[model samples]
Target: MAVGATPKIRLSLSEWGQMFIAFGALAWPMIKALFGNAPWRMFGSVEARRDYWRNVALVMIRTGGHWFSIRHLQFMMPNDRSACRLWGWMNWTSVISEQVDMTHGAGEDSAAKTERNPSIHWVGQSPQPVSTTGNNSQRSNVKVVLYIHGGGFVLPLSNGCITMMRTLLRETNDPSYGSPVYLALAEYTIAPYAEYPTQIRQCISILHRLSSRYGVDPSNLVLVGDSCGGSLCLSLLSQLLHPSPKLPQLPYTKGSSEPFAGVLLMSPWTSLATSAPSYTSNAGSDTLPPNVIRRFRDTYLPKSPDLSPTSTSGAYKRVDPMQVASLSGRYYDAVPDPPIKGLTDGAGATRHMDSFDAGNNKNDEWWKEIGSVAKRIMITTGEYECFRDDIVTFSNDLKHANDTSHGKASEIELLRDESFHAVLVSDFAFGIPPCTLAAKLSGWFLSVLRNPVV
Candidate 1:
């Protein structure tokens, strides 16, 4: 079937049956756990170490993730429109649909492909333009975080994502933080519903609207994402720094060249490839299965077009999903040195420049341009997650890039916790108490805003 095609009613009924069977299979184990008959040791080394309730939750999550198909999961979750409407009915939130004009900078050829307007969910009152004249400038005190949610690029905006954003909004508004924060959660077309460049375009449109229409200063805007959302964050940064050939150039607002306040990435899926050692070592610990990851990767990436070698000219060349998806790989010529031991906390780490020659590095120019999009970047990953190794490698490369290019120390910070993937978001979703990592994330945001990089 073509991507984004709706399933028939009969197919939906079959999927519902499959979902029930999948859940029914877990009933025995769940009952055993409730009766204290199932020991934690049987769950695996990593899961065994977690609290009993947490272990049970992990089992259920992993089961759902593995047994369910993308379509089935999509059917179970609320669509973006419905999610936005639900949020609007709550206090202190609103939703608005913004029409995207692809023809603005993209030529007519690109614009003729699709017509869709995306929605933005606000956690507080929608921001309005403030005067910058005189000493009454309110722009400096106002911070806006534009969040891109993750669902393996298939599922719609999740309640967990919304909960995380609300928590962040509350934390940033504390007197200690002293910033009136505004949160905007972007809604984009996911995979099977759409492919590459479509989601990117919608995000770029939302960003442009925020800056141009709402008069948000780029310096006050923060970009945040988790899981696949983190990948989207990196993709957006990549597009801004190095324009993708497949998409139109982003039109910048006034002072758009100024670096953003910060970027917060929670367990970002840096690469689709599962060859990293963590994939094997943490297989039993993480919630995602290798096959499931591959399924998502295949569904999101466009199949290569059939063309003869000679006919593969510039006009026919396609954007390589592998290259675009792997931000760390694209930034460094070689695989970065393995992360140093005992560097889990958010602290400055020693740079490994011995293997690299500054003058000879092909991406030095790109590295130097890091400060153009984001002044400060903070990444959080769990020690037991499948993407841990790649996240560490990416953090090291990013830190080195920023320090070498801008002569700044600690431009990048990484926090590694002994938990599962997207642990912070999960904490909010499951009503688990805040962990050390969550506290640090809030602190990082406040620190960045309070001490702006001039």
Candidate 2:
């Protein structure tokens, strides 16, 4: 070596490799301990844990971990992928049966039937008709709330969610909506197999299929989705754009066109691309690390940097549900080279961020494209929720979407505080703070769903 040459602190290849392994081992447990520790546990009781695991499993799959991987199987991993799909399915089955009885009295036969049926029965392959007092002859102003349960993409509905759903169903008739209510809580398909477009497609499918069955006036429809469900709400509205894109495909709703009168999002996961301010701001407050969001991408997308080499990828980007409506105009782009407007030219554009220029596009172009869908797009979440900033940013975008469209169709409401992840459910069973947070969440969402705009 030259005498004057500066020496570098070089380690042997083996030493470098050892360092990485050590960090992975040390770091993995450090993170897990944060979740496993009692004070940090989001699900304090069986009711809450069931909801918590469902989201955890779904997020795990997205990060490229297989269902049976050491990480995912701690819960009923593969017994049912739908079971694995987060939220909205069955977190709280009994809550509805109780609500049904409290709302609609049970005769001997009715009570017996309800006893046998329970709310879980409401979720079966062949759902029985929901008992209501309204006569079929003349329908009044019926309020319809499209409730989306928040599970990472796994676990069925929870008691908190079921109670929440029932309360909304009842509120519509409580002189609040001034009409009898019919609720369609989306039992959307979850990932690993269903992934991206599949969940959103099924959400729209249910809306179209049920609108006729329930006599739902398209104009009176309201959409509500929490956590992963919130993602679904964004996906559904994105499809309803005006001058609708018959081209520029998005897996969430590539070939559908169904719209809602309004939408409500709770603790939603919005953009999957950028690092928003909340990532750091709400970092410690998150019961689940933000990395879980990235982990969920592995379930369907191809092996990207966010996922491991052994991880898989699909033909889709997991699809961010609440990207500002303005950025959604890939379908509105006039450029032929890039089928998706605003994205870079060619196949590479579908999954990568290249020529992303939503600013150049006309204001309200996406809102106009979404046309008159989801008149009231409101969100309710706690400040401590890691997803807070994302929702805030998206809220700003929705305001922008409304301004550009020059339409009064869009609006939002916030119920924010230091409550942690899934505060609606978690706080009830755990946390020093009284658990009325979820109840308030229920009330907040119902108010918006009822559209008492002031």
Candidate 3:
């Protein structure tokens, strides 16, 4: 089987036993919620408490996310087709998976062979042929949203992410938006199967294919990601602005320096450190557990010597740049040893840092170039989520960067809602009612599309 490939649907006896144990464990919480004695303090908002099923689902996710192995969860969750069928909107929307070449225009020999080829799921309208006219007239008003799903970089694409995309597609194409929108969900290789630059390389390949083959304009593409996926998006931006030593530089067809129209980050996991004030303050309110975050971090960026080039492990045989760079890259930050107290609490604390200041000493001038990647940028986070402090600090740094680079404070926008981590997508995934967050996100997208940067 290919690394990170979707496993066969058949479940082993152990998996079945685990499922049984999970159900048995959840019974008490189910009973409590049934009797109106549910732990409301644990939930992020009143809206989450209102839905019985959502409450139950949150408990299951919180428990399973912390306890269960990635393999077990992969089996329990439905495959892409099954997820679409469960939604019953499969008929209205078209979902097609295509294997994208990760070569980035390099010949076969130049590219490393891996079983985990990056694929994309075209959700609504697939790409149309570009006009041969001098102006490329037909694609002038078209916008493609490349969605990188959030699962801490380990879990598969969830049904909630699809629901969120469908809703965004419908909302963005409305008359109010005044533009035709298409969504392509990126399916990159997850962690443990692949690490660091591999996922970033896959994303670059997707972008390359979209522009080179489909003739989509780079300026017309919007990058959207949530959670760790948001981290990937930030990595992509960093790669574009300052090319990673390990990955190939993306070839922009138009030769225009600007690569994207807009970027939307939903509850981006900016820093992996669990010592942030929000991690302690919002522990009860947010659905994400700190242990789960640590597990995902370790799996994605393992410190074991086995991953060294001299090691014999075939899975991660080569010593990638991540092994050398560690977490002090442009986006991801290394966890502090002694741990910084309230590091992200104030703008002054974060303004001088390069990437989430976990005591890194990198020069902060590189951040000023962030405005060159996209015309407009919007980052949304939950006020009660564990990542709130980090996202806030990152946003502040990003705003300062853009202001310093472009002299426009309006170029960067931060939307902090009174909810938990990834509440909008999670709500849609659990079939919870649409909230103001969704509407606000839709408005932001519309505003971006309506106003072209050029």
Candidate 4:
């Protein structure tokens, strides 16, 4: 081989198949638009306005494409060992507390400041001095934001995630509430590299590290995630509330049984097993198409043997067989009946505990156990998002579980604003929903700290 020669690239059939999926995802929206022009372009509906601004904000972050676009193609297209080495830099990042440096915002100014000052001052895996550019002082409040960034479980945290965290920490300063926030960005292995529950276990590791090192109280820690990250957060919550024998045990659980302070989910991808009404009704309005959604689903939890015409099961079969199995049952099999009661939705509607006959009491006990964890759960979804219905279902299911267990329904506050899927995670130039949503999140975090339930 010559010193300055260009290397020839070859992709396996599987890689080619991935590329085909990527092309399909890219083309689906364009094809839909061609058939009957997007509603946002036609009628200027709230949904259209949201879709427009969010994409604009995304573009402002960087050209080429969104982080997911790059990740999607990279995962699908096969590369040789040499090519893998060349692209390995983009695939993953280290998760060690001392090594991970998350600068709050974007732009050359933040970059320059980070370069000059010790942005992340690590002291033996403990909470280091978190200093902003202007202040140069330490934050007094002992709050940590454990962020699980979203990109269909394939992409790493984008500029959007970094910027959102920076903005939230900067803007969310209330004189009344003296909570200082430090970010602990959770980095997990993406799929095609690792499968479903592996991401869950990685999250547990991050949680443990944050607790053991930073001395962050499990209750003071806020589990915040968007898209699939949101899904992971909820999944983790379910596991915590109701432990399963099949699943591995989580270490460093604060040496106590109390749950985290609060859980905030932004446009969580809850149900990948099937499509919701929003998948079709809001398909054109959403940035993510149905096929693209399924592609990610296929990568993480491929079609089960029963579902597929082919009898063989793929390596990634997390959701395949489990689709027919009751995950709730599995998790709650060993958990005792929950002690908490009076769970309800924001609407003040509650289910009657005795609505079902005594025969179903065993099932009700599991729901109760699941409901007892998490003092606060804030579910925010873009009204026109493809995930809207599933989120609604998730909320309702939790509410029902609370009702069945406690004999009264408790409120699960849901914010269904006019926006597209992943509005908060995406960078936006001018959008009412994203900004308002951020403010709401700040307020919620403050409330959680000031008036912690547990």
- The candidate maximizing TM-score is 3
Model 1 residue runs over 4 Å out of place are 1-11, 33-50, 87-112, 129-141, 175-179, 253-256, 306-365, 406-410
- Per-residue accuracy of model 3 over 78-168 as CA lDDT, tens digit each: 6544454455465466676677776543432233456356777777557775655563334444678999888877677877898887786
For candidate 2, lDDT tens digit of each residue in 1-454? 1110001124456545544454454455445534754533454775455445534433333222211221222122322222322323444332121111111212112321222111111321222233335543222245566677665553345445544555545544566544455555455434443333445445555554444334454456677777877776766565444212321232123124233556777777665432456656765456544444444433333234433343234422333322211232242111111123332111111112221343434323444434355545667666766677766766665676666664344554566655555555543322223345555645655665565554
Q: What would the TM-scores of all predictions be?
A: 0.76, 0.56, 0.78, 0.61
Report the error of model 1 at residue 44, Å: 22
Ranking by TM-score: 3, 1, 4, 2
Off by over 4 Å in 3: 1-16, 38-54, 79-91, 104-112, 130-141, 175-179, 253-255, 302-363, 406-410
* Global fold similarity of model 2 (TM-score): 0.56
Q: Rate the local accuracy (lDDT) of all candidates.
A: 0.63, 0.44, 0.65, 0.52
Better of 2 and 3 by TM-score: 3
> Candidate 2 or 4, higher TM-score?
4
Clashes of each: 1, 41, 1, 8
Writing each residue's lDDT as its tens digit, candidate 1 over 57-131 gives 677667666555566677777676666667667534566544444323444245426635555767656677565
Query: What is the lDDT, from 0 to 100, of the residue 137 in candidate 3?
Result: 38
Tens digits of per-residue lDDT, candidate 4, 1-454, equal 2110112234566546555554555464444443334435434765556655555543332221222233434443332222222332343422223322222212213222222111121111235444445523332337777777777765554545645655665544444555456666665656545554456656655555554445565556777889988878876665565443434344323226455677888887766633367877876567665545554554554233433424433322222211111222232222221111221111101111222222332323444654345667788898877788878877767666776764323336889888778877664324324567888877777677665653
For each of the candidates, the C-alpha root-mean-square deviation to the true structure, in angstroms, is 9.1, 16.2, 7.6, 13.4
Candidate 4 — what's its lDDT?
0.52
